[model samples]
Target chain A: MLDSLLQFLITGVTVGSTYALVGLGFAIIYNASDVVNFAQGEFVMIGAMVAISLLGAGTPFPLALLLAVMATVAVGLVLEALAVEPARGAPVVTLVIITIGASILLRGVALLVWGKDFHAMPHFSGDAPLHLGSATLLPQNLWVMGGTAALVLAVRQFFRRTSAGKALLACSCNRTAAQLMGINVRRMMLLAYGLSAALGAVAGLLVAPITFTSYDSGVMLGLKGFSAAILGGMGNPMGAVAGGLLLGVLESLSAGLISSGYKDAIAFVVVLLVLFLRPSGLFGKGAVERA
Target chain B: MHMRKRFFGLILGAGVLAAGSSFAADPIRIGTFLTVTGPASFLGDPELRTLQMYVEELNARGGVLGRKLELVHYDTVGQAKEAVTFVKRLIQNDKVDVIVGGSSTGDTMAAIPEVEKAGIPLISLAGGVEIVEPVKKWVFKTPHTDRMAAIRIFEDMKKRGIRKFALISGDGGYDKSGRKQVLELAPSHGLEVVADESYGNKDTDMTTQLTKIRATDAQAILNFGFGAAPAIVTRNVRQLGITLPVYQSHGVGSKKFIEMAGEAAEGVRLPAAALVVAEQLADSDPQKKVLLDYKAKFQAKHGEVSTFGGHAYDGFFIAVEAIQRAGGTDPARVRDEIEKTRGFVGTAGVFHMSPQDHMGLSVDAFKMVEVRKGNWVIID
Candidate 1:
């Protein structure tokens, strides 16, 4: 029983680390532009698919991964220019609908381009099973956890230490005031989308090896990541990370102790209960005045 | 001697004319509806490839008794309703003389009434003994039925002295039917099923039911989910450290399952058709040659490992043989010829059909295999 708990933790955290990475993408984009880029998941899908195609085409793994991330960031920038920019000053509801529509378009395009099939990327690390006492850990899983933490820290430093990052942060805090103070809010928004998509793409590439991925896998991943964002309180990046990791760990624990059948439900239900008890989330930005 | 030569020439010319006249009127078209994309794409891709191969081979040999054969295909995306709609389109627009059904039993089941209404032979490439339950005369299956795999798993378990077992399945149509067969058939094979649990394909967690399975006194586990669910289930099972042997349904594809299972997939037994085992079994091993040829040709064409699509390939080629035997695409005659098909070497097995039985397989055709280093090692 104890070993199983540790096993679940390992599996769940590995999965959650990817989810948190994606959730951070969502939180970042939501914070910057308030567009709620529904196509966030599709960026991940594109990354995985591109990596797979490249790998199949015999491109080395690292090069293929790099290209996939760059390609996703490019796609994100294009999405901003084509979809988001034109819809500026549009109603938030319209923006939401448009982004959702964009998500559907992306899926359709993926299905057509990639064909409807699931792909399993070659594992990045060796598969030699590692046993620590009674529990076992996969080497790739360590990459997953470490990569996620590093990304979170990098995102923190990027926002705090960089000048352009500060401008973006100011925009998120007060878009009108930041613009009045001569911040290029529009470019910052574009940068946010690019960065967000890059994060999702990286997550997708990392997760693809462990889990079989299809054009449709993004829907579930996107939903879970979105839920993580909500659970962590939408605007807080750190909260999103914590929520994602927590969600992953919690789900695993329940699967260890309770039932896999209800693991998804258990995770979501716990989130709901948390919202009910503490609407600000475990570490969300404190309650705000209604507009 | 001169008179004899004239008579032989006369008969030859007459035969040529008859063949030419028949060709001018209508070519027999076989329309297929299957999940060409999505999780089940593996199923339809192989079936379609086999159908194409049969068509090419038949056309090259003499056009299925001097009439050209045409094939139409649709990607159903694994939705049952989509399959039915595609079948309808094939019947109405394409005027297909025969219907080759899809990769999924649910879609095939939903497509059956229309196929029967059109009175065309519907050769199914999916499992789910239910497709043949009502005994539609126009319908036939080339794959093994649920009874074969389910009972085989039980029989094999009993042989291994695993009297007590547990079953976990997806609540989807085929999985549900497969689960039912295990429940109804296991006891007869002397395996006692201690617990049964179900979940859906979209389900993210199967640990709850698996936890229940862990608590049971079952000597082994019988698994019946497909795609990601099975992969997740296997991982969860290992995570929970319930070391009982797991015997998976034949629905578990080799590449998909092993990858999904990761390390936990080691030592898991799954029922596979002779197609997946043909190379290991023998080159002159009849069915092995066909499957090997298929695997080679399929890879050459599609650039991927053959999965459950192998079964699909077998079903379709056998159907082509029927069309070839029938001498034309007459629906009634094709159905009759398909029913009379015997000793037809295919990817799955040497198929033999009778009027009452659609699936040409018996318990003898399946091979039990385990994943070792991402390869299938046949145990039985």
Candidate 2:
């Protein structure tokens, strides 16, 4: 019984870590642009597909990893320039719709480029499971948990210590004041897009070996990521991480203890109940006022 | 100016008349709505290609019933609403003599009411038994039903002296239907289901479920899901260090499943059509030649042969044979002829359609196969 408990915890943490990465991607983009980029999930997909092809073509794992992240960053830049930037000054709803459109377009393009097949990558270390007392965990799971932590810490450090990150935060806080202070608000949006894409790509690469990759894999991941972001209070990075991990644990425990058929329903019900009790989410600021 | 106008009008009239006369020998129209662009594209793309290839070959050999065969296809994208719209167009606007497609059970079930009202023959490529059960009269499917897959796996397990096992399934129509059958039919097969669990369609992890199954006294595990979920389950089972035998459904007949599951797929058993191990079948087997030919032709064009496409191949030939036997493009006649089809060997299996069995496939259609060194090998 203890072994099963340990196993569920491990699975929850591993899956939750990936969800946190995706939620962080959502938080970063929402912070700068005030528009949720639905195409954020496609970045994860692009990273996985690009890395797989590069690995197939004989590129070293490290080089292929770098190239995959760079490729998704470039895609994010193109999406901003072609889709989002063109519609500058649009209403939030319009921008949201455009992001949704971009998401569909990216899915179609990925299908054309990669075709409709599932693919897997070799584990960075090996397939052997690490023995936990009375339980086992794949090495890939550790990679997922470790990589998510590293990315989350790196993002936190960038926001806290770096000037460029501060400028982006300023844009999120107040566009007019940030512009008056000589910050390029538009540049911040582009940076946010790039950073979010890179973060999502990292998430993809970290989890691709375990979940495998397919052209349409992004759809569900994107929905869950968006849900995590909303559950975490919409635009708070720390909240996103906490929300993601919590959701993952809840899902795992429900499947293990309750009915597997009701696992998803239970997660959604809990989220709804939490939101009903706490309208601004667990960590969301309560109705901030501005001048 | 008046003379020139008259001359141009005359030329246009003559052109129209010539076109009308030629079109009076109108070709037999075959329309299909397939999941060619979305999550189920792995099934629909190949199904579409097989139909296209077979139709082109037929036209090259002087067309069906001496009228040119006109094939119209639309991508349903694996959405039920998209399937409804496209299937309506196929029947009402395209005026196709016969229709084929619906790559997933969801798509197929969604289009059933529309097809039944239209009264046109529909040869479905999906594998849900609900698509044909209770004799819908106009709907026929080519793939072995989910119930057949369950019975085949249970029989294999029973033969190996296993009576109690666990079942892990995805929450899809195919998986649900199979789960229902397994639950209902276990007692008949002298088997007991020790543990049963289900996962969401998009779930990426199954370790928790596997852990629970591990604690059970089930002798083996049989998974009933389509697409990559099964692969994830296979991987999770191995990751949890469970050594009991793992069995899968025909939904995962492609090599991609093995590739995704990596070393975990080794020793996994599945009940699938003979197409997966086509090259290993004896010459005396009836399906061997048909399977080899379809595989060769498909691989020559698309560079791969998936069993999902083979389901379409069977559907196409079944429709064509019916058309030829009916001797015309009339929908009613075609439907009648299709119901009369029997002993027709195709890629999926030797189909024997009837008024009672629109699916036409029996449990024998599924061969027990085991993954050996990353390749599918016939076990018995």
lDDT per residue as tens, model 1, B101-156: 77888888899999888888888888778888768888887778777888778767
Model 1 chain B: worst 10 consecutive residues (lDDT sum): B1-10
Model 2 per-residue lDDT tens digits across residues A1-291 = 888998888888888888888999999998887889999889999999999999999999999999999999999998888899989988989999998999899888888898777888889899899999978888888998889889889999999999999998898888899999999987888899999999999999998998889888998888888878878888789888888998899899999989888999998899899889887677777546554
Indicate the docking level reached by candidate 1: acceptable
lDDT: worst 10-residue window of model 2 chain B: B1-10
Which one wins on TM-score? 2
Model 2 lDDT on a 0 to 1 scale: 0.87
What digit string (tens of lDDT, one per residue) describes model 2 on residues B136-247? 9799999887788888898889898998999999998778888999899988999999999999978999999999999999999999898889999998888888999999
Off by over 4 Å in 1: A1-12, A48-68, A101-118, A121-125, A128-134, A273-291, B1-22, B37-39, B72-75, B85-95, B166-176, B194-218, B228-244, B255-266, B305-330, B372-374
Worst 10 residues of 1 chain A by lDDT: A127-136
Kept native contacts, as fractions per model, are: 0.13, 0.93
